[model samples]
Target: MHAIDVNELYHILYTKLGPRHWWPARSTEELLCGMILIQNTNYKNVDRSLANLDAATNFGLAALLALPDGQLQALIRPSGFYKNKARYLRAVLQAYHDHYHELAALPTPSLRKRLRDLPGVGNETADVMLLYVFMRPAFVADSYSRRLFARLGQDAPYPQLQAHIAPTMRLNIAQAQEFHALLDDYGKLGPDVFGLADQYQLKL
Candidate 1:
């Protein structure tokens, strides 16, 4: 079987799906807060929670930080896991506020490490923040990416898969962001879209 060409796959997906309009947030603070609120929840719930937060405090990091614990939890209740999520969101926002200026000056690797050090920020979440929020050339090898590549006969864990694919594409920030969005949206289309079930199969 031939190796899956990451560039080719990216192009194919992009051609079919166009732009994904992903990471639907207006500001870095909103995106960061979303990075926490979105955990273990669906997009709709996250959207609703973001809307609730916006209505209450205009979705500013400072605003969220100023909210009382109960108020914060209540606003994000729609996203589920309200108790833990509120704590994590508060911690992340506080950290971001503390280092807001310093963060913009850090390199991509350093920024990713710093974000990872924050509460509830994992590799995938950090990558999402890097690509969408910070506009870094980070590839998010999330579950959708894994499933999509696995179907095309390239199955590896997060780090390996990320390393394998990131360099191959050599994408700029905009392209990298779109690739992730397109891949995830395509993954949600099941095994039939683009005849992927057969077309992308390994030639065993």
Candidate 2:
């Protein structure tokens, strides 16, 4: 798809969905924690897990760091992949505790690299943390984003797609975060807003 068309799609989606208020978190640390827990999981489940923790404890970095692994696993069970996700979370938290000593002191690039280096944290997860928590300019590409782009006839693979789009968007960190939130909201609300499936016919 042409860059103009991509931008048009973004505009249409944004107009339809408005602001998504995504990556819902009570604090920066919670946002980062949610990003790690949310891999391979739905937002609803992640919310449930976060609420579970919030209701029972302080839900701060210190509390999370002090919590036993088994307890953390149990609290986040709703997000699924509890055991592996818990291990990944612990590794990330430990890295923060050891190096930064406080979440605010963690440099964005350094924290992002460290997160990407940890097991179970990939580009998407790392970018989520960077964008939502660190307020960095990082675009996230996932399955729904790929499907949307493919439908619009862009042929790049996921990684290349991100690289191709990020520069073209010309958005700063805050704008990138808003752009991603808008795209995700579109995927969730597309059928209802477009009504294209029933209005048009496709050979494929």
Candidate 3:
């Protein structure tokens, strides 16, 4: 297990991926909802779900809470795990209503903690909400991140990858945001840009 030079990887991937413009949310609420819905599914599925929801109504706190569970489940079906994702969405909306009385009123840390405590939420999902929706400094890790680091020969586990990359991201919130976007973009481009065959000795 060898350590990877993330700074070098960052530069290489950035040059390959260019500007990512990640998270792809139109609003704070949409971004937060997308973060939850995106789990275990591709962005295309997530977009389909969002489009379905958006076509029917505004997808606001009140609108979503007002919708029937079955209807909501149907709308977000594209994201897969419909019933479970619906339940998770309902719980998060309820938490917003119950605790802060409104989405705008919720404090970043408190909201993040509450969301993280929910059944389906995990570090990656929570960090997405924190970073994209709340504009916080949280780092997000996904399979792409893990694969990229592993292909670079960093033998550390996924959890440890965050610590390794965070410090090198310049300690500025904006830089962290860009760094994440770049990594995500690099991931979206797949292994081709990272010299996957040369690095891992595998054929594409």
Q: Pick the candidate with the highest lDDT.
A: 1
Candidate 3 residues lying further than 4 Å off, grouped into runs, are 1-12, 97-113, 192-204
Residues 154-182, candidate 2: write the lDDT tens digits: 65677788767655665677667777887
lDDT of 3 at 41: 92
Question: For residues 1-204, what per-residue lDDT tens digits would candidate 3 score against the true structure?
Answer: 223355555555567666566665666557656877988998899999999888776777788788898999999999999999999888766765666445435675576667679778887887676666556666666676777666655546656876565545543456557667877777777675656536542111
Residues 130-189 of candidate 1: C-alpha lDDT, one tens digit per residue: 887778888899988888788788788998887777666667888888999888888888
Q: Give RMSD to native, each candidate.
A: 2.4, 4.7, 4.9
What's the TM-score of every candidate structure?
A: 0.90, 0.80, 0.78
Where model 2 places Cα greater than 4 Å from the true spot, the runs are 1-9, 100-112, 190-204
Cα lDDT for residue 189, model 3? Answer: 79
Clashes of each: 0, 0, 0
- Top-TM-score candidate index: 1
The TM-score-based order of candidates, best leading, equals 1, 2, 3
